[model samples]
Target: MSNNKMSRPADALVEVADEHLDKVLHSMAGETAVAHDDQRTAVHALVAKRARVLVVQATGWGKSAVYWATTSAIRSLGGGPTLVVSPLLSLMRDQVKAAELAGLRSATINSANVGDWDTVMQNMESGDIDVLLVSPERLANPKFAQRIVPIIEHAGLIVIDEAHCISDWGFDFRPDYQRLSHILTASGATPVLATTATANKRVTADVAKQLGDSTLVLRGSLARSSLRLSVVPGLGPLERYAWVDEALGRIDGSGIIYVPTVADTERLSGFLASRGHRVVAYSGRLEAGERERVEDELRANQVKAVIATSALGMGYDKPDLSFCIHVGSPDSPVAYYQQVGRAGRAIERADAILLPAETDEDLWKFFATASIPDVDNIDTVLQTLKESGEPMSVPALEGITGIRRGRLESLLKIVAVEGAVERRDDGWRSTGTPYVYDEQKWAAIRTARAAEAELMRAYASGRGCLMEYLQRALDDSEPGPCGRCSVCTQELPLGGFDVSTESVNAAQVYLRGADVIIEPRKLWPKGVEDGRSGKIVGAGPGRALTYADSPGWRDVARVMSGPDLPLDAEIFDGVVSVLSRWRRQWQRPVAVVPMPSRRHRLMITDLATRIAKIGKLAIIDALEVTGPAPTDDAASLVKVQALVAGLHLKPGVTLPTDGPVLLVDDTYRSGWTMTIAAAILREAGVPAVLPLVVHQLP
Candidate 1:
């Protein structure tokens, strides 16, 4: 077995016999053509420069091949071992399997060590390993430092997979990744290589800055042309289950359903199984053996779909998957995009579905509640690790306590927190393995959330479009009205309608939680006078009316009877404020629109209903809810009214009301226009007033 190690072949390994390359590519499963144009360019760029490279490549672009090729090239030239720092243990295992399959000698040091840690250390020290694969946390370990660090220093190339972790602001933050700079600096003479699938401009710069002497190689198009994006809104529990059934029924290849919680994953898996679909569930709590069995099923194509949380996609690459659906909204767009990316990996047509629920506001609020873990939690986590007699690595700390990286650094700052955990020069250790999962830390998070009660309240109840807000935040470019989003395709009105004559007189107060209370005057002290009493009244359900007085008030109208008519702008503003509040308060779905007048309330309603049905709620604030007056029997009446009031409808499209209708108009006066509009709406065979208006004067 001593001679079993495959020596590095000379001459850049000569494409591994072409047949071998074909085998490697085909192993990716179903993806026969490796037409990754960007990846090819990036690899060539690195090879030509003979410089250390930081390659930011997207998933399924064959990033693994780039490293394998580069390593083979260096090896042929008598280069030393290539040290690869990967994220997951499973990835290390996969690398080993792939290397063995490729006729190479590779070894990995991780949790599933076949021998004791000391034996593994001796093997690496003896230089028996050709390619060494270690976890990010392993690189920071004192034990690893004492023995393997010297071996790694002797290596000529260092490869970091999923290098985006180094960019603190990126979606997958790991505190151990922050230490890569130190590790690379200490590696003495080795040139470094980096890779990842997701990163923004800021994160990209940070990766380069942190990895000294690095040449950046970015490959592949961010666009997933093969996948179709669809959103189903307003679906109840039964509808959600049916939707999943339908989506799965439509696809032939394997599929995945990503839910936000472990409980949901289990529930959905059971429900689907009851329906006779070969389904499985995977989550963090599952035993490793059980988890692997399910994964094997997915890889073997024995299961039609796997209902899981975010943990399912890492390490396992399945190209035949038709699509991945989000049973509920993810906490952020970064996460949503990442999960959705798993589908269509082989560049085939796939679909991503978003189903929102009424409790969505609560979930969104939960995100806001856990303020980046306070300085104390960091301190506690670090101090606990240090106090523990065992010399633990970063992953050990994280694995034991489940503390994420973004909050790790800050938590480490408190006086109670210890600075760094290191092995004694000699390596063996004593005091204690001080880690404890602090219940108080969770308590503090909850307290912080409670303090911001009003803000959360607004978020849960406000409405417009959830996807729009998520897209603007996640993608650098604007994805205006994705025609298929819950907001764009909604068929019912969720916002209360406004029927006012004096175009601007009827104020539209967008609301979350269905109720709001406002003090009449800003300067009034508590108990000085009874607070201004009013109802958030409007034509649609979520939309309402509120009062406000501001200078340069446009199109002013004095109220002769009803509470002082606030401008529609004021009402819209109030709605936004409430929604923002609800997001922090109850974690409800909320969106705010600036102009509540003239906009079609029905469109907003339909969008909200759809979102609620799908188990996702969003607070979207838009200015264009108004439509124009119809001129002919076939014109879009909603568009006609929207145009008359100069409402901001998404550009270049009219409401999809079927059939021509008679036109009707009236000056913005008390209920005059609504009365006329309603009469005409009935005559035109329009089933109901499209849910969009500032107010319908009673």
Candidate 2:
């Protein structure tokens, strides 16, 4: 792989490719596009020699132009539709609209528009669709395979946008993306073009192997002169919000503020809104229309900024996104680059600011452990499928195996990529592919990711030139300092790491009032005891003061969760304040009941005693634990059974019979403990139970 990896086979073909690019540009934007030599070389490969091409370039470089130009050239010569395997639904929608502008008929088949899938398939079969874009996950879908895979097999050209996802070594590797290999193997002589802006040498090599042995990888200088980078260090979660709130007025135009977790998006966006900045929260959890609406709002500059999780960045087209601010640094520099690249794509200059938090590394490790497949879990899934000799839906599998839904889904995707399992229209079935735990391979990957994480930490600490640091991490051809970043010029944006006292106080107040709701479980885990076989009834919602290491009340949560310690007066006051606000949402509880915990009984009891005193409510011990606590690693049903068997409304107790009671606990994890406690109370004739906890594990 070289910066100049491909050359024109002949002068005439170059001329034709350049002409096609010009046509694509004129049709798409009615403006002339500069003929980057590598772009022409890629188009020539698709049009003339029909070669496999992989392009690794900068963010603002027009990777889409190469494929659109080739599609136009190939279609002019009577070729069939070009299949594009895109990652995100938002990206696919943007691509389809862009294709139409480039004089090509394009339609997407994704999870969101099942209704449009049939019509789009018909168009593809009828040759009316010149560019057919499908998400990588769709290729693995049984229904999509039965319909579109056949048509796509004969596609004139295949383009994989954001091609870094094809590599297991990629910063944002997706297991569903491995299905693209099936297409590559099946599309006999069709020209293939894969493009991405954020792949290192290692990821590039892996993706090229997936493309083909002979694939031409065109590497380019990843120097984005338009992006001026800076870092604001040592900001707590609340302080970060305050800094953004105060800086909104100074920031030039609408941009994005990236947060580490989905929950933070809403919290940050809400705080910014209260400060009189028009903003919206964006996350993958949002519905398709809502995500699109947010994207459109940001693009139109109708809002100050979109406080979002990292999912909002990739392939989102905003020409003049003025600033890219991060509340916490991502685990890797590649991921950080991919995110900040969303800005300055069509502008003279854009600011990329990072506010690094101390909690980011722990979050990275947690998410990493969650995504990696457990050997025993994978074996259980495969062995169960083998014994059943029939397709098993994900829910059925979960019931039988007791793997949680989220982890099970992630595991299946990873195994499916290895051909050890297959998902069909009916359900998932084993493919008889023996599951081997590749210790060496997995260890190597972990090592690589660990190195990348350390590199990011180095970047945050200002070890070297910021631009050169990113370029080197990405293995850019020309890695050099831009001489415009905070480090090089000894300047910092947004007040040089000092936030206003007023703003910080305001943020702390807002955070203290924000309590995350915990929805009660509706259905018992399958395979539980006969007494717990159906829908859960008589359970009410609950609330947690802090979740997942939120800095809102970090010290308070620590003190509350510690063993046998009395609740601090300040902590008790915060709970009272929360109770004051939560009172509106529910009927005032007549009594305070401490949800019995063997380990933290004194701590919880102390807190309950104080709350009982404050609310002028009767203090009662309505529930008590007799049996052992649930095994931490046990299945959901087993955990439920442990709690159910142990938790008995105290042997002889008189309940309030009509009013709700505050069920106080120190921590909430799994929520089964609280659910069973509430069910016991309701069975004993209490009308409702309101759970209050200090910490909620994510």
Candidate 3:
């Protein structure tokens, strides 16, 4: 297709679209002179008829251009400002900039801009803004919802970016996105456009159904001609790290390394940096400003790669990102496609490599279950609110129902959607609306997820052409072998990267030194006794090697803690190395103490004695287990209660009056055991307690 033909607007809309296309090109610094015909069609569909449309196009296909141009065309027609329901802050930031470049003033209302909400609203009311971007979570905000109603009634267009999030079948389904259905109903005749790059047939149908009847669905080819897909499966953690270190030098340009967890991002980033790669870690945990800084660095090629979680997955605008390497397989092929789509956007032949690990399934299960709401917990929350007959704050609910604050908040949102509960200024109150548990629906979702997981496994194992397998998994119409992937051509350029023996050994050494920081629990959990529920005073920072970190200390720690397995010299040496590195940040302890464990007392004692010997400190038996340990899956309150009842000071053993103590344990989970132990020692006159654990559980 010629640029002239692609740029030519449809009849009757040619002049207006040409003007808007020029504005978009200007905003993009004249990167291209023509907009795709699909882009022009989407724009005209919105401006000419105020129609609802779904555009499922490949990444870098100018989906953003369609919306920005549509906003421009609508404003020229004296239409109200457009509203964009984006899924992430990163996406919103990019959209706001694009809107400005397209000659449309845009402002965002999200958690990061609480102070600027008033200013944004004022701009909207004064006709100073042409587009308003918001996160799905903002729709649930009572204040924002009330304030946005007037705007919604007159909105020129509503764009749901990453529209796959609205489908339960999507890998990244979010309940908050479901709130859009209500907004659509209230939006009346306002034009709506849903855009996404990764959606299977099921997700496409679901999203279209949500947008109402007669929604124009425009889906383009899912194939990315610029992407070269391959899989390097069965690599352990250390090997993967070494492989990345070696591969980074051979890759074409700056790129991203996607990990399955936050800890993996930090650990892998550190390992790569140690191997002389300029890299940084990016996760949801980072502050907004810090995330933006890292994004800018990647865009400018200041860093070779940013080891990131899915938090960096959507709408990160680095047009020339040359490669995307996954340390572990994503839960579904659709998600993997979406992430790999970030690369090869504006370049020819970007590498997309997947290094699947044995532990990927475990991570997938953890994440899948974490998002599904617990029926019992939801019912308990609703019943409590109903009994109260008034609004109650989250903290108060925590006290009444023993649910952790985070889980409680999630449950509240679920119930609020069901109309069983409502949020007010004070807190949350029940609406007396009876709610039925949707067991069948949840079961179907679980079944579908299991199938997706199997499909991911098949993809990693080279059951067929990599691209074709993914396309079929997404139910794309034109599924076929690309003839460029490793499987189809029997050539693997990604796996051809060489790793020296020295690099592999260095990676192993780095993995062995699995030191991790154990953050102290500052506030005691609610529903506990007042004496136990206040601020924990003498707790200090703690350290550990790894948290179930596979193919590393996790294996060693498991063997050492198992029945009849003794601590070895090599494991002990690694512990010493971790402590040596941690000592620089920690105050030198005056003494060392051990927390008694029912299953691993001997291992804990050995570790403590070894650490004390190395540090030249006294080994004190400060606390002993009074009863059995709590179950691994026990709730936070249950764990605390069991620890409080089971742990006690050793007979005739008094802690020092004014110096820090090294409190050692075999492993750390909920930290209740360490918390209670530290409290006991502190009450006995110890000034500060620092926790050291061999392994930490995620």
Maximum-TM-score candidate = 2
Residue ranges of candidate 2 with Cα displaced over 4 Å: 1-16, 494-497, 631-634
Q: lDDT, candidate 1, residue 499?
A: 24
Model 2 residue 144 CA deviation (Å) reads: 1.7
**What is the Cα-based lDDT of residue 565 in candidate 1?**
32
Mark the regions of model 1 whose C-alpha exceeds 4 Å error after superposition: 1-41, 44-50, 114-128, 217-220, 368-371, 376-698
Ranking by TM-score: 2, 3, 1
Error of 2 at 318 (Å): 0.7
- Write the number of the candidate with greater lDDT, choosing between 1 and 2: 2
**Residue-by-residue lDDT tens digits, candidate 2, 283-329:** 98999999999999998999989999978967888879999999998
What lDDT is reached at residue 130 by model 2?
91
Report the number of the highest-lDDT candidate. Answer: 2
Candidate 2 clashing pairs, residues 3+ apart or interchain: none
Error of 3 at 401 (Å): 3.2
